[model samples]
Each structure stands twice: as C-alpha cells, then as structure tokens.
Target chain A: MDIFNKMFGKNNVSSKTVAKERLRLVLVHDRANVSPQLLETLKEELIKVISKYTEIDNSALEVSINNSEHSVVLVANIPIRVRRSMNTVC
Target chain B: MGEVIVVTSGKGGVGKTTTTANLGTALATLGYKVVLVDTDIGLRNLDVVMGLENRIVYDIVDVVEGVCKIKQALIKDKRYGSLYLLPAAQTKDKTAINSEQMKQLCGELKKDFDYVLIDCPAGIEQGFKNAIAGADKAIIVATPEVSSVRDADRIIGLLEAAEMDSPKLVINRLRPDMVKRGDMMDIDDMIEILAIDLLGVVPEDETIVISTNRGEPAVTDKNSKAGEAYRNIARRITGENVPLMNLTIENGFFQKLKKLIGLRDS
Candidate 1:
C-alpha cells in the first residue's frame, strides 16, 4: 500500500491534486533558493549519516521547503527500513 | 498623500483592468477621490472601460515626458464626481516610460487623490516594474485555472522581492459549480497555494460583459453579484471588516438533476 502510494506520489488523476503537487514542488525550489539538484544532495547526505547506524529506505525520502505565516521551512521525511541496536551505535 | 495600489496579474485576460475600474468606481462612490492610471501603455483599456475614452487629449506619456501637466492629463469620470483616469498613450508601447518616471507620476497623483490605482500590464516585465515602483499595496487578480494560479504565485514572489509587503489576492471569475464538481480549485485551495491575504472573490458574471460593452462598470448596478463583490472589496480597502462574498454552488434542483445525470451547466 505504501509503495503504491509512493508510486502515485501524493498526486492522482485529479487536476486539483496535480496542481497542488506542482505548486508545492515549484514553491519549495523557489523559497529555498536552491536547485532540485541541491535537494537531491541533501537527501544523499541525510542517507549517508543515517545508514551508518540503521538501514534506511533511501528511495522513500521526501525533502521539501514549506512556508508558514512567518517563514519558510526545510522539511525532511525519510522512511526508516531497519533499526540497529545501541551496541553498534556509530 | 493617498494610497497607491497596483492591480496586476502575470497572466493576461484575468480581469485586472475590470477589477481596477470597478474598484475605482466603487471607491469614488464611497466618497473618495480616486485616480485609475493605465500603465499598459499601448493597449489601454481603463479609459474605455470607465467610459472616459473620448475625453483623453493628454495621456500618461505626455505627463511623464513633461509635455503636459499631470493635472491636465487626468480625465474625470462622467458618472462619478471624484473618480478620474490617466489614460495610457495608445501610440507608444510600454518602453515609452521607465520606473523613475512612473514613481514620479504616482507621487504627484497620490497627493491629490484619495487612492491611486495603477492598472498593470500582464507579464513580469518593465511595465510591471513601472506599475509597482510607487505602489504602497498590490492586488493580484487571477482566475481559478492552474496556469493562472501558477502565474499569480510567481507574481507574489516577485512582489515580495520588490519589498511590497502583504500583496493582497483577489480570485476573479470563480465558478462555484466547477469547484463543486471537483473540476476546479476552491477558494481555500487558491489561498493556500498563493499564501496571501485574500481581499475578495469576484464571481463569474455575464453582467460584466454587458457593462464593459456599454463603457460602464458593473459596480454601480448593485444588482450583479460581481458588482457586490467589488463593493465589498472597495469597503475592505477602506479598512472596513467586510466578509468575503460567498460563491458556493447553490445545489438547486436543476443543478442536482444535472449532477445525477453526470452533466454540468454550461
């Protein structure tokens, strides 16, 4: 189910949903003042740090910039695939 | 000095001039001296829409070029005592004026009128720069289409960079029926995406066409929904706490029947 949702990628055939996704993606890039390549670099860096301790689902990472009434925020939501014990903490 | 507001949309044909015209007319009716300046230089429409086209002897170019006094170029509205229009030069294009000249004109107009509303041309270009150079506020108009919304978002970003704080949003020509059928975006969706204070929502009304053809704004009609929306917007501009006009689908019997039959009202 999760994988299917990922395949659909928070967007469906509905025009409204498509518009929402498009606006979100463009606005995130616009507000962060960074290219999409930078976001991929951030995702890679995040994976490198996390993979040292626990196995992670590198494919299901979501990094975006969202705006509020006061400021724009960089938000990261990466799915964890496995957890390692503290005995192997890095 | 008066308030200088720029009515702009990055996309064309989203009712920017109509909004400017109606707002100026409505504001004047509320007893404020308002001047509507057309900054769309070559493609002037404010004068025609305001029914003061023939009275234009001197235009914005003349005033900006120091060929005529600014006062001489302002044509008073025939219906409203306090409303005036500084027509754009039809012979010249947008390149005829620069930001500094526009700022000067706005400064001069602000001292005399209670509100100076500039009708901006579409696109993020020199004309847009000139329109907002002296503006104290911005009102972005856009239809509910995805392309329109996208352009409006871009305009908002540009306005923010221009240091024009809190540019207001006005979603124009919204069709409630389409929204209900899930074919179009609702007002909340637009407000969220644009992330701006929504000043007003003007419903799609055919009366606008009739009035525009007659060289009269529908704001004076009082019977049209779009007119009422414009009136509420005008009052809001005056610092009144007017509620947003409801443009929700009525869901009447015919509408329900159409829905049951999987048909939409044309």
Candidate 2:
C-alpha cells in the first residue's frame, strides 16, 4: 500500500509547468525574431570582436539570448587569462 | 453612464463566459443596467451559459445587418430585470461583424445601459478585435495555471498596445490546497508574474459546473463561495470597498483565533 501510494503520489502533469515552457519558448522567439542560426552567428561575431581587445579563451567564451515579454537581453561571458613573469628579462 | 468593460481570456475554457455572465448578473443585482454582449460569433456560448440561448430570435448579426433593431435583438434576463444580453450569431462567422460595427453597436447600447460587458472570443483574431473596440476597460480572466497566465499576459500586452488603460485581473479556478503544498502557483506569484491590478480570485467550485449545467449562474446561490466571490467583484466594480477574498486562508481555527484576538485586519 505504501509503495503504491509513493509511486502514484504528486506525479501528475500540471498545466502550470506546460504554460511556463510554452511562454519561455515563445518569448525567446518573440523578443528579437532571431533564429537559432542567427544566434550562433552572433556568438561567433561577438567572439571575434572581443578578441581584438584581449586574449579571450575562445572555447570558454559564451554568448546567448535571454528574453522576457517586453525585452530581449544578449548575454556574453568572456574569460581572460593573463600570464605573469616570475623574473625580469635578463 | 458607467463604462464598458470587456471580460476576455486568450485561452479557451478559462471561464471567460462564466465570469461575464456572473459579473453581469451581479452588477445588475446592484441596480445597475448591464448589457452582456457575446462576441464569439459562430461558436457562441455566452447565451447558453446565461440560459438565454432559446430566446435569441434576433441576434447581433440581425441588428448589424439592419434586419432588426438593436432593441429587438437585446434579450432581458429572466432572473435579473436590469440585466440584458446581446448574443452572437450562431450561423454566421466572425468576419460578418467588423470592429467598427461592434463599436457602433456598443456606442448605441451605452446610451441605454450603465455597463456594457463584452464577452470576447478566444485568441487575438478578428473576433477579439471586434469585441474590445468600444470597451473602456478590460478584465482578463485566467486560471491559476501557467498557460492561462501567459495567455492573459499576452492579452494584457495587446490591450496596452491598443492604448487601453490598466486591465484588471481575475484569477479563476484556484485550488488552494495545491497552492499550500507548493504544487501550484499561489495568487501572489501569479500577480507578481502578471504585474496587474487584481480584481478578484475565484476558487474551483463544483457548484459552478452544476449551476452552469442547470443554466443558472453560480452567483445566484449565495451559499456558494464562488458565488460570493463574483458578488464581491460586482461590488468592487461599483466602487464599493469590498475586501478581497483570501482563498489561500481557510475560515477555520487560525482565522477564528485571529478574529477573536482582533488581529484580523486588511
């Protein structure tokens, strides 16, 4: 009885979860009208632009899109590595 | 004259018709002359929900097409003498009535009635445009679920884009037990996500289904909690200071203790 109860308890699908997923996807598309391909292109361009300023770890850098009902947010994370000399050049 | 208000939900089966029927009845009970217009066109149900489907001899199309006058098309509610219904055309599609025609009809109705409540069709389509054309305010009805709330948010945005002022919200069919268990989105969470003024919250009551089946409004039964909530919404619309119904809090030990100690305050 306990096993049956545990197996069936609170595992039902909810409308709220479905709605949240739908809204998330729709908002992502609705904000900038940017397709996934375009996002990839944007990420590549962002990496190229940031490389001119500093040595950015290309593999570690990330760029993506975040959206809400009213606005689209472009998020980018760049990791910069600097090498320090232990002694002055002789 | 009082303003025209449209009760709309972008998602179907979220109780837009039910809310419109109950609110119209409640408003009329308060001595306000209210006219509930069904703008669903071919898929009309507001008339049936209000139990006036059998009486719809001349519908909105007849009035729009000049076959019958608006006065002839309007059906007075059998229960509430002050309430009226302008039903949709069952045979015709939504394309038959344009936004301008709806605006004109509502304008004419405004001369006679204090409140003109339009029951908008689901989706952001021609029917929706026609429904909200002449409304001064909007009331978005949504269930506690995310899909309903998301649709409502979209509808609210559409209303804003149309230059309509702050649309109030009605979160319907909220199951408080699920909310307490952290299974469902609480009222506060919904309000936070939607960012709108809350008109009222209606609990999921089986009495609503029974009453709808009987072709009677749930509000007519005073003993029903959902009925009381609808009445309170009516009172609020009339500029009364009716306290919001707290669905999350049951009227049991905690409530009684708070009241007994005079700690209960809005």
Looking at chain B only, the TM-scores across the models are 0.97, 0.93
lDDT at B249 for candidate 2?
56
Model 1 Cα shift for residue A61 (angstroms) = 12
In candidate 1, position A84 carries an lDDT of: 48
What is residue B52's positional error in candidate 2, in angstroms?
A: 1.1
Q: What is the interface RMSD of each candidate, in Å?
A: 1.7, 3.4
- Model 1: per-residue Cα lDDT over B1-266, one tens digit each: 79999999999999999999999999999999999999998899898898888899999999999999988998988688799999999999889999998988899889998999999999999999999999999999999887798789889989999999799999999888777655678889999888799999999999999999999899989799999999999999999999887777676898768755757685
lDDT of each: 0.89, 0.85
TM-score of 1: 0.82
Show where candidate 1 strays beyond 4 Å.
Answer: A1-13, A33-90
